[model samples]
Target: MAGILVYAEVRNGAVRKASLEAVSEAARLTKELGGSVSAVLVGAAPANAGEVLGKAGASEVIALAGPKFTQYSGDGYAAAIHKVAAQMQPTAIFVASTPQGKDLAPQVAVLTHAGVASDCVGFTVAGGKLLAKRPVYAGKATLTVKAAESLLVATLRPNVFAQTDAGAPVAVTTREAGEVSLRAVVKEVLAAVANKLDVTEAPVVVSGGRGMKGPEHWGLLEALATAFGNAAVGASRAVVDAGWRPHDEQVGQTGKTVSPTLYIACGISGAIQHLAGMSSSRVIVAINKDPEAPIFKVADYGIVGDVFEVLPVLTEEVRRLRAAS
Candidate 1:
């Protein structure tokens, strides 16, 4: 049986949670295929990073390291991955559906002439072929795609699959990222102001909309997020378009798609476009004064009150609960 290869995305010398999810999924799939699971770590990685992947279920961890990989270069990284894939010739290659993964997956597919399924929520193998289930039509419909090539390449959406440990150590190997001709190089990376939590990776999200009135009123949402501790702040498309929040904070079909454990929609009248982004959330709580708001339709819990009047009370209650605990 051919092996499975997972691209373990690392940043700041640690593997990202999304890549760990991919690794876990790859391990599960490899068991079904009766093959071993291997992972490729690109760019600068910390020592013992392979052991981390081992615990996450990779039987073999390949570290591709060099000064050229210190920072991300799309062309260079894609070439390195292609070289590794050529060497391994695995049955399937899995990548996380992150900004970097989005850029890298297609390039590797194109280089290898392989069929690719992007933003896959789930997949299954049958008759020696891989089938992937993905969201389409603003996530209102599911599209199942089958890979025709010998190798299947796919990008798994973040937070969709749970990560698990394999309870054993694996072999680690290092390789030099040989020379590659690059078209563009990332000289500098400017990061946004760090938040307590990243919206995409957070388990809980507290979002506000135009009903918050103005940008000055965002403190209410922040206070609520603070009460949650692990929560991130999000914004509706209307507010984002109005320049009240950054594009990264926007949650909608036109912006970022999120699937958090709990989603709190404050003062948002859910539009189809907005719902398309967050409908996958496990639990939804909608707070809006209008009982007729569309958000109530999808909300597991609903609150009918003005956000200004409701938020402070909710924040205080949460703080009180935390204090008591």
Candidate 2:
């Protein structure tokens, strides 16, 4: 019967999907604890942020306005978060487990001396204490934990909680946007690659393991992704470390945890470290020449054959499906 604070992340004039999911999770937590959810943002006042958060199930929206927020400054964002938290005094706080959210939460936690939980899969309040489920040992094991006190901070993995419209009217208010000044400035941000799909936004991902042979043969994976149209190309830790692909494309226990609708594994051996990251996919397809590969155990569909041979057929089939559609 208290208030839980949810952080809203906005970029390119819209709220990020992960931020909405945080609101959704916050809404659920608040409902269980009999508390209201208040959404917080630190940016040039979002045009309709209040209504947007309300639609996403936020009972209240606290906008910390400052032009410096247009671009992410960790210190500024953290300082602003601390300011808002000190004012709201919510029983609990929730933040998305994004790159920025991970970077920003510690400042507030230190200020309030609240226990911080990162990369939590889910949460619940038990015996007046907050309990959380988090991945440990690079995702090999999931541990359930409880915060020492009610003042709590948490981060939720992306793609775990799908975003949906709250469908409720939200009231708007204006506040003084705080200033955060820094000596160093961002020069520029270059895209990973031209026309390359964003790893976080892809619905289907086709990843290559060490069996792909070498970097020169990456064309096979790219062609498959191209055939899928909306699919992104990903790589296993071995493939990335071997210089076959950028590190950003790596998906493993230490890398991004994705829940794509479909995932195609080419030449992957399915190390426990690798499976820990992608086991949550809705559907998994494996292509490996070795029948004994560990990946087949978790795959919904398994094709035992050379990826070099199977990939062309799969790519063609996907292309034909897209063409017919």
Candidate 3:
């Protein structure tokens, strides 16, 4: 029987939000296209990984467990997913638009000779065909692409699709990981100092640019992020290139793209490349001394003041509100 297969990506022992979003999107597709929603869990998934995917609308969970699967191995993961796709004969395969997923999707497509749509923000089924909408030209335009081959593979962008409740647990199936010719393997992973939240996954992000004057002034932005409790710190390419922040903290076309619920830009001029990364944020607040700063054009609220002056007051106010609540 034809079904929809979702690659449920796990990070730091838990399933990634983008993967759940992909599964949720698959669940919706199943309702429209008349098929079952099955998920493949790779890596050292959490004990409740199956339950979590089930709640996200996966009717069947295929757990590929092994020591080699603990860390992300592109060739290994692609091989395992291709094997499952061959056995299940899924009509469409969904993967999240993450670093690992981006690598894995193309490999799976090459193996299956399936048509691929990358970084898709939305999906729809019509006349038994899968179509996807994705950003083009630095998100200035959206292109709707159709799958021409029998098998469809697409990577769903994070935070673009909304997740829905599936209401109950579904069946979980365990499968032994098949052996593949190993050319390369990840021996170890070095983690960075832990932040309260990953910038891509954070609901709220506080980002600063060159307006803060220098790296020494980063404490202001950090304080603001601390006030939000669940917020993550981000930086523009300028700050990152200037050695004021790590590249991981950078948000721009060359850095990580983010679509947080609330994005606060401090001392940023909002270059087009920078805007390309975070313009999709739900609510944007730009603080810059210059009213004509490009950031203000896209900001839902603009504050014309020095970031050093504005940040202290804003951070205190946020702390006060949180305490009151």
Instruction: Kindly list the per-residue Cα lDDT of model 2 for residues 223-302, writing each as its tens digit.
Output: 98989878888889999888888988989877777768898999999998888778777799999999999999999999
- Deviation of model 1 at 302, angstroms: 1.9
Each model's TM-score? Answer: 0.95, 0.89, 0.95
Error of model 2, residue 134, in angstroms: 1.0
Off by over 4 Å in 2: 45-52, 169-171, 179-187, 323-325
All models: lDDT?
0.87, 0.80, 0.87
Pairing residues by index, what is the TM-score of model 3? 0.95
lDDT of 3: 0.87
Cα deviation of 126, candidate 1, in Å:
2.9
Those runs of model 1 whose alpha carbons end farther than 4 Å from true positions after fitting are none
lDDT digits (tens) for residues 1-325 of candidate 3: 4779999988877888899888889988888887888899875557787788888888888887666776678888888888889989998899998988888899989998999999888888888777899887877888999877888899987887887776367656778876865566778766687534778889899999999899999999989999999899999999999999999889988998888989999999999899888988899999999988989989999999989889999999999999999
Instruction: Give per-residue CA lDDT, model 1, range 259-285, as digits (tens).
Output: 899999998999999998898888999
Clashing pairs in 2: 55-166, 65-177
Clashing pairs in 1: none
